[model samples]
Target chain A: MSYIMLSYTDLLLASLLLMINGVLSVIFSLGLLKRLVIAVTRMVVQLLLVGSILSWLFAAPSPFWTLLAAFVMVAFAGYEIVSRQDRPLKGFWSAGLGAGSMTVASMVIVLLALTTQIRPDPWYHPQYMIPILGMILGNTMTGVSLGLNTLTNAVRREAGAIEAGLILGMSRHKAMQGVIRQSLRNGLMPLINAMSVMGLVSLPGMMTGQILAGAAPQEAVKYQILIMFLISGATGFGVIISVLGASLRLSDNRHRLRLDRLASGNGK
Target chain B: MLEIVNLHRPGLSPVSLRIDDGECLALMGPSGSGKSLILRAVADLDPNEGRVRANGDERSQTPAPLWRQKVGFLPAQPGWWGESVGDHIEKSDSVLDLLHKLHLPDESLNWPVSRLSTGETQRLALIRLLAHAPKVLLLDEPTSALDEEARKSVEALLKAQLSNGVSILLTTHDKKQANRLCQRIFHINKGVVTEAFS
Candidate 1:
């Protein structure tokens, strides 16, 4: 089977389908016309730019390029985590915690997968490295962001209860145990749900894309399973690191809840 | 016994005070006068420049959890994290007695925390503190939410604690209540602590 490349004309045909969405917005007075148009435009530009970058990356296949690509993705994810918070930690701590943990978890998992499961030449081959890192980092970033956001908000809301825990003979770690557990659950819940209903509810993105790209169903299933496991590992590691780090940073060794370390109240 | 030497924080004057074994000291101050500040500092819940010694155990040297358990502090509106009263207030043989003493029924232990009245919450917070029986109690208006009769029952509970050699540092705006329970009263205004005449 030959993989037929999508031409610019075929892309234009896809754009026509988006017109149906625009038509509905206009009919219902949903006021989504502007946003829909802008979003679709941005999506097109961004994805095309990414495609161009990947072409360059695949052409050169330098370790330096791969490293730069990974760093850039992680850095953006770090900022996204901070911006998503309702009450983010003050100053550099937010960015540091998110980015630092993401780098640790996503990089480690991707490297392990590359070495042990799919041994590509030079180990940092852009073909495999970029997509795996992208998938892992995307999910891991969400997990870390949700965990940190939920944690800070919960801590702020439960200030009295947490202090009570401290006064009730609980260590700082012990006092934060409940919140940490909840945050971890919040972070990993999506992965859990997705994994449980993987094939029945909806086909996973990688599997669908691989099958669409003419890969055999059996082979595509293998890659999808491997990717899902990689994502799960990355998400768990990422959430734990960020949540634990946030809990520790927001409290002191004295078991006191240092709410002042947080930047103001809720953003909304 | 508890001793605080020159405890100072932002917007608070340096405070030095002592409570003997089985003694009660009252800190009298209006709202925002740093009454809770002093209690928090003594409890090591906040960063402050001070030396707090409880039963010859220096606060800085002891583990924070141990120190807090030793020097228990309750805020004006104690926080309840659990869903039910029993979750916040531990069950014990003495706890049942304390509940009856505070005029709360045994069923209150099963009551949802959200169902508790302000007065009940305050009383239950007291019971929560008493559950561990800290060596020192830094209470911030422990009876502020209670009515006259309820207040009387809480006072009885404190008196029993005192006789058991538990020292207390109570903050209150009610002079009559302070006079009734505290052996010494210190008035605080604008961060200043001066002996108040009974």
Candidate 2:
């Protein structure tokens, strides 16, 4: 069976289904109509731009272009992490800690996988590199940002306890070990919950997309399993690095809690 | 003995003072006059510009953890991180003795920290710091929340610590308590230190 293609008319018909959401907003006075329009418009514009870029990459693949794309993706991921934080760190740390860890984890994990598991003709082929890197960076960004958010908030909340421990001769690492562990948990919780209900409750996104594009169900499932494991590894690595790095930034060489480094207010 | 020379932190003026071995120096100031910041700076808890010496040895010579071990600063509300009060307080023989002296029962250690009254929290905070056997004690309003009887026990406990050669820097609003307990009272206003010879 051949896969069906959507024309402009078909796309417009599908958008009609979304009208129910606007109706509900109006009936309930939820004030979501404005946001709903903004979100949908933004998604269409962004996805179309990405699609055009992907087509161009496929037409002419090169290592430099691939690297540039990867860098841009990670940069945006870092910016998003900073934006999502309720209380971002002061100065360069607002972007440095999360983005640095995410770039390291996603790049290393993707390189390792492309070379060993899913080797295309040229390992850096845009066909393979772009999609894989995009997936890995997206998931890792969520994990890292969530981890950093939790880490910053916890460090602020536990400033007193940390000082108590420090005054008792405990090192900064020892004082913050508990907060780091909890932060890692918060970062990885979404991935864990998704994996726990993978096939039954929710089909993995990559697998659903692959199956729709006419890949065999078995092939899609196999790739889905691999993708799931890869996402988990990347997310786990990113979360640990980001959380530990953020914790270190919250304290100083004197083992004292540097609460001034944090932006004011209890985080959302 | 702890000597702080030209101790300066942000929002506080320069402070220089000395407390000899077994001496209790009372720090009296209005609210928000940086009394707590002075205590914190002396403890090396905040980044500051100053020279703090314990027993004539520079504090910066030692590692931060070890430095903190020798000089303890108890905040107005001591932060308790553990579920039970005992988790933060090591129950050594001296710790038990201090708790008893502060009128906190041995059973109170097992109680969750949320169960402690303000006076109990203050007393327990002192006991926790005393467990370190610090050479210099920076107490921020150590008896502010206590009643007359409890305040007397706390003062008695501090006297015992002082006799054992512990140098104390105390902040209090109680003038009579300062006159009674402190050898010299130093009033801090706008971070300027003036010796009040009573």
Candidate 3:
């Protein structure tokens, strides 16, 4: 059987359908037109900038340049995660370190383990490494931010109980166990739900993209399964590290909750 | 025992007060007299320019969590830290007994907090705090929301707890309640604490 490839006109019609759908969504939604416009504009600008950069990176892929670009992406994502919470720059370094380490480790491991036959020049392949690392780091960043917020807020809200526990001969760490557990659950819920509904409720973006790029349906499905599993693992590890690391900054040497500093917007 | 030294608000003279262990000290003052501020400062719930020590340990030296646990605070309007009433009580076994003593039924554990009357919620909050068994009890108009009978019952229950070796420091605008509940009274005026009666 021969497959009929879509012509330029068909592509144009497809693009127009997306635009019309967006417009219709904006019209039917209440108080969302401005937000929709802003989001669309932001997407256009960001994609255009990234498109240019990726084009250049792919044209001349060097190890040094590729690593530098990845570092830059991680740094920006780290800053964004911190800035989004209106938190201080204190956690910026930690977040950057966490994101950088996790993304690079996962990307390298997956690439080496799966795509070892790709080529001799493997570490800096823009097509495979960049997109995969971007997805992993982006999800990890979100997990960190969510975990951090949930942990901090939980500690604050339950400060009284925590104190009660401490007075009852519980150690500081023991007192914080509840908050930590709750934060972990809250952080991991999205990833868990996504995993639960992987194929039934929605087609994941990576698999959909791979299929659209003409990969076999079976191959795309396998990759999707691998990526989702990896993402969940990365997210879990990232959230735990971020929470534990962030908690260190929130207490004093005596293991007391340093509310004065964490509060009053100083941590931000 | 609790002590406050140089506790002063802006544009006011320093105020000082000391309460012995197991003593019920009533703080009485008009509005804006800074009575509540003293209770908050002692509880370490407010930032202030003063020194507070619980059982001879300075605020900074003592662990705040330990201090807070030992010091039960009932604010004028209690704030629930959880979504449900049962969530606050599920951690311990004595919460049921306290709830019963406070005249709240077992079914109240499942009732949405929004549905509770101010008086009932206040009682529930008191019971919640009491379950922790703090060494010092700080009451900031704790009975302000209750009816006359409820107020009397609460006062009697608190009076009975004096033998439990807990220090009680309270603030109230009601002179009659103050006379009935406290062995000593301190009147705050413009941030200055003065011994009004003993």
The best candidate by DockQ is 1
lDDT of each residue in B1-198, candidate 2, tens digit only: 999888998977888888999999999989988899899888788899988999867888888888888988889988876899878876778887887898888887798988889999999888888888899999999999999999999999999989999999999999999887789998888777755765
Error of 2 at A265 (Å): 6.7
What residue pairs clash in candidate 2, if any at all?
none
lDDT tens readout by residue for model 1, A1-268 = 4577889999898889998999999999999999998999899999999999999999989999989988888888888888898898999899899888888999999999999999999799999999999999999998998999999989987888888888787888887788888999999998899899999999989898998889999999999999999999999999999999999999987788899899884466
Worst 10 residues of 2 chain A by lDDT: A259-268
Write model 1 residue lDDT over B109-154, tens digit each, in one string: 9999888899998998888988888999999999888999999999
- By lDDT, the candidates rank as 1, 2, 3
Which of the two candidates, 1 or 2, achieves a greater DockQ against the reference?
Answer: 1
Report the Cα lDDT for candidate 1: 0.90
Candidate 3 residue lDDT tens string, B1-198: 877788755534577767778678898988878877777666665545677776777877777666777777777766554567876666456877766677778888887877889998889878877877877888989899999888987887788677776778999999888888787998888777755776
Q: Model 2: per-residue lDDT, tens digit, A1-268?
A: 4688889899889999889999999999999999999999999999999999989988888899888988888889889988888788888887888899998999999999899999987899988898888898999999998999888888888888777788777889988888888999999998999899999999877888889989999999999888888889999999988888888888888887888898764355
Off by over 4 Å in 1: A265-268, B194-198
Candidate 2 — what's its lDDT? 0.88
lDDT, candidate 3, A111-158, per-residue tens: 653465333356567766788778777777777777777877777777
Candidates arranged by DockQ, highest first: 1, 2, 3
DockQ of each: 0.79, 0.71, 0.12
True contacts kept of each: 0.74, 0.68, 0.06
